[model samples]
Target: MTQDGYYAVQLNSIEIPGEFDISFLTRTSNLKAGNIIFDSGTVMTMLDTDVVDELVRELTDFVSLPTEKPVAPHFKLCFAVRSTEQEEELPALWFGFNGQSGNLRVGPDKLFVWVSRFVKCLVITGTNDKVQVFGHITQQNFLVGHDLEKMELSIIEKDCTKLHEP
Candidate 1:
């Protein structure tokens, strides 16, 4: 959490590998200390322009789908999925954090938002400014806890959609 009491955490890096190889083409590991913010208020994650550009490059190379020009209100990276089957072909992404935070994997279903049955837009985007944000969509299915006294954040994986069940 920030000094103002917003639930936020720091990240060490965000990485996306090449389409056909494990070699990473885009890795934002050298971020300034405590620069990234895990924001619950935002719907989409945001990164610096250079980072976003590299991520776009890697994703474009990885996803073998027809490109669609970004339309209004969906101006990040958008693609045309021919069918439900095509949407399943998108590659996974990862977020790495400092210390024992480990790595968080984001699959295609979590990475893209379906605008239509045939159109899907990337949930990650670039910011004109230097603000790096970890948005809520990526936080789905996780129980996040903030310990103000200890100055620590705790994240536990769980099925958030099933929270109401006994």
Candidate 2:
């Protein structure tokens, strides 16, 4: 948690271009410490407008499918997939924290959603607001633990359905 009462974390890096292993961390100043906050109430992750624009650009170039406007007003990027299998064409995206050894890997299942039968959009949106939110969509199926005493947050993927089993 941050001193400002936000559950914020420092984003160390982002892996967007999978095959080339390229990171935009050095290219942008928006990836600053304590810029991202975890918010369970928000259904979709929201980044700064500038950050989202850059991501949209990269994604538009990377994804071979035809692009379209999202049916919803919030989302800025959408793609038309021929079938569920075409979702595999999306490259992997990961968000790494300052001190964490494992990056939060977000696959197509977690990253994209079908707004319509043929159109799928990124689960992330751009916010002109002050705070950038790491929403529940990306945090799905993960057990997130916050240690207020140590001011730390831990996230691990789990089979949520079997969590209550002995």
Candidate 3:
């Protein structure tokens, strides 16, 4: 946990490549090697305002879906979809952490939310604050373990509904 009472991880890389083109985040070198606060109490992930602006531009161009005005005040990225089931059409985001062997891949379930019958909004928002927050909405279905002594964080995908089925 950080001194501010939030669990933090060394976020190094963010991947969202285009199969036929280069990565959408190729020019976002400024976002690398930053600490992101992992707070379970917050429902939406919040990145730096400038970072979010760049991401919004890339995602808007990458996703073929029609755009929608934000349903919520906190978010600027949204799309008009027939149903949440179309999540597969959205790109998946992978976040890499230092000291961790593998990247944490967040699918549509963790990246988006259904605001109305035909509206799906990105769960991540932009914040003017210096701290980048990784919220609970993006941590759903994952088992996150924090090792204070080693100063490391671990995340594993799990079916939380059946954690104690034994």
Candidate 4:
């Protein structure tokens, strides 16, 4: 319940299988500002190109290498087109993070919405095979934990920069 809308989640070990080549994520409009984030990102995702390289080399434990053909990474933008009705007026918005994109696409959707808007996103590409999870749109504000006997993740919705680590 912080200003950035952060919540407590168990940072358990997760395994994304076949994490190679390109990753894909589906962003769409129709999301409300008062609604929860990252609510529609439980499916496969894609990364642009440069974002992929940086993400792999820094964020997670992945390997980067030289390639014959390099690609520039991009991001995704999703929104909604509100109308008068709900089902009869489903106005959705989703577009690739490519810098050259214009209007929202309308046709056979490319991805699904299973991600909440509560986490920072980055494009991660490993081995230059396929791009994956570029980055979410949200940023990770702060995470406070205690390691007395077990790891405990709590919700700290306040200002606490005086306790930052160097």
Candidate 5:
């Protein structure tokens, strides 16, 4: 846990690639590695403002959907989807950490949340100066573990619901 009470991890890079084309966006090469906190208490992921802006711009260009002002104050990008079916075409995101751990590939199901029957908003947002927070929405379906003795964190792909089944 960090001094601020959030469980933070060192991040190496964040990348978003076109689902079917060549356009891509990446934020890496930080002079000092950035910290990304995994916060279960928060509902959406928060990244540095510049990173978020670039990501939003790239996604907007790729999808090209008519935009609507976000009803929620925290959301900056919200699109009007005719149906949930439209979500199938959004771009894919890859989050890479600083160690030997593999990259996390995020699909639309984990990346967006339905605001209403017609609106589905991306769960990622921007922060001004705080370390990035990886919220619960993006952590779904994974079995996460922390080891204080070793000062290590481990995340494994698992069906969390069945963890305690007989």
Candidate 6:
């Protein structure tokens, strides 16, 4: 485990669909890398840029909102993603996190929601290894749960307004 305590799990043959399904493998760090390289806190789960691209196309007219944190350039999408499970969608949800000042805050100001269905990534020079990242997307979407022993992420569907914020 890295400093933050994320267990590197390798998922293979994952299917990402938006009418057309793409098969690929994925890795996460929650931080940049890990003990050997770029690392941060645990509970790292990231989606590919290809997933982000798909969301942009499928979820047309997505309202772009301004963010205080400068994780990525340009505006971020402020909405939660859901599978067409049934007639009713999940409720709103928020990710509660300690701010830079150690104070907790929540919503359009604190977090932005993004889905894997809206991302795309191509080959960049020297990037023949694999596309991977800790990501602002994961940080914005999940709430880390730790008991000084085990760490896990739970899905919240309270408001689903943005990410985690009041």
Task: Tell me the TM-score of each prediction against the true structure.
Answer: 0.81, 0.85, 0.85, 0.20, 0.81, 0.29
Separate clash counts for every candidate: 0, 0, 0, 47, 0, 27
The top-ranked prediction according to lDDT is: 2
User: How many angstroms is residue 99 displaced in model 3 relative to the true structure, after the best TM-score fit?
Assistant: 1.1
Considering lDDT, which of the candidate structures 3 and 4 is the better prediction for this target? Answer: 3
* Model 6 ranges with Cα > 4 A deviation: 1-46, 61-143, 147-151, 155-166
| lDDT tens digits by residue: candidate 4, 32-118 | 221112212422233334433443443233322111112233323222313223212222222222212212222112221213332
Report the error of model 5 at residue 78, Å: 1.4
Candidate 6: 10-residue stretch with minimal lDDT: 120-129
Total clashes in model 4, counting residue pairs 3 or more apart in sequence or in different chains:
47
Query: What root-mean-square deviation over C-alphas does model 4 reach?
Result: 18.3
Q: Is candidate 2 or candidate 6 better by lDDT?
A: 2
Residue 125, model 5: Cα distance from true site in angstroms = 1.3
| Residue pairs in candidate 1 whose N, alpha carbon or C atoms collide under 3 angstroms | none
**Model 1 per-residue lDDT tens digits across residues 1-166:** 4644454455655666433332223434344435567778888888776766777777787778977877655347889988778878776777766544567777777788877767888888877654577789877877777776766777777888899999
In model 2, state the lDDT of residue 57.
85
**Ranking 3 against 5 by lDDT, winner:** 3
Q: lDDT of all predictions, in order shown?
A: 0.69, 0.76, 0.75, 0.26, 0.70, 0.30
Q: Which residue runs of candidate 3 sit more than 4 Å off their true CA positions?
A: 18-34, 83-85
TM-score of 6: 0.29
lDDT (Cα, tens digit) per residue for candidate 3, span 1-166:
4445666666665667443222223323223344577889889998777777777887898888899999778878998988555566888787766676257788887898889888889988988776778899999999998887876778899989999998
User: TM-score of the candidate numbered 3?
Assistant: 0.85
Query: In model 1, where do residues sit more than 4 Å from their true spots?
Result: 17-33
Model 1 C-alpha RMSD to native: 3.7
